[model samples]
Target: DLNQHIDNEKCTKIRKQIRLKRTKIKKYKKQINDYSQRKHKYEVQKSILKDRNSYSKTDHDATFMRMKEDHMKNGQLKPGYNLQIATNSQFVLFYNVYQNPTDTRTMIPFLNTIQETYGHLPEYIVADAGYGSEANYMAIIDNFNRTPLITYGMFIKDKTKKYKSDIFNTQNW
Candidate 1:
């Protein structure tokens, strides 16, 4: 296994760092709750201003002040980097991390990195529905020079009704 051949001491250190990150996320949650309490009070003040369409007043002043304070305090939240991996039949050789929140933007960047490292494009690519989009599909054709067989999860909005089929959705396409 990979663990048996890796440096045990370095693995131990990485595990310790992960524990610290978990604690940091817990603290961020607590701070967000405190801000929510203050924002509730501001909502009461805002209600008074709505009754009178007249010019500015102390209630309006208080609302703006409270909103600004809450925005500043709640700015920090639990966040993490995204991990991207590229694997082949033989092995998983490439992985990268970024702050991107969705797989849509990641497809091209990941392919580019793999090409740079391996000196050739992969013949096939497979990913979940989250990574399936028009842009991502085009990237596979234009950038990777390969046709990706993408799989998307089929979901029906109305469970009671059968999905209507059209020419575009048929297997013939």
Candidate 2:
């Protein structure tokens, strides 16, 4: 009877140890799950903060622009400022740095910068098709009183005969 009593005590002790081990395992699993959830939440928050127009952390004023780097053949977008330069006779007449990546909106601002510095606008302005917006043309004519010798965006396409379906061909002439 004493041996049986001792056996029952040992069985109860083993069961208690098993229950304790299971409780510890459950606690550890809950902690791991909580950590995983917190990590995921932080990752989501980080992604949410990153927007299309997000600036560089190193240079806050510099915006993301596609640059022609030697290492990157695909032209990766990096943080940099757009430089606008006006030249005459192979000499740089005026230069400015703009935050905007596109040249279409930078023409007027660059011209205005030149005017502000020189106190007079040029008689004529010449630029590529990229600076051929109507607003820029109007600004050159009305605000600066200068002739804009800029081409339209589709100037090359319009010049090609293959693109012109309705225009009469001069091959017969």
Point to the candidate with the largest lDDT: 2
Q: Global lDDT of each model?
A: 0.63, 0.80
Stretches of model 2 off by over 4 angstroms after superposition: 1-52, 70-75, 166-173
Q: What's each prediction's TM-score?
A: 0.45, 0.62
Q: Given candidate 1, what's the lDDT at residue 105?
A: 72
After TM-score superposition, the amount by which residue 127's alpha carbon in candidate 2 deviates from its true location, in angstroms, is 0.9
Clashing pairs in 1: none
Clashes of each: 0, 0
> In angstroms, how far off is 40's CA in candidate 2?
21
- Model 2 — which ten-residue stretch has the worst lDDT? 1-10
Of candidate 1, the 10-residue stretch with the lowest lDDT total is: 59-68
Top candidate, metric TM-score:
2
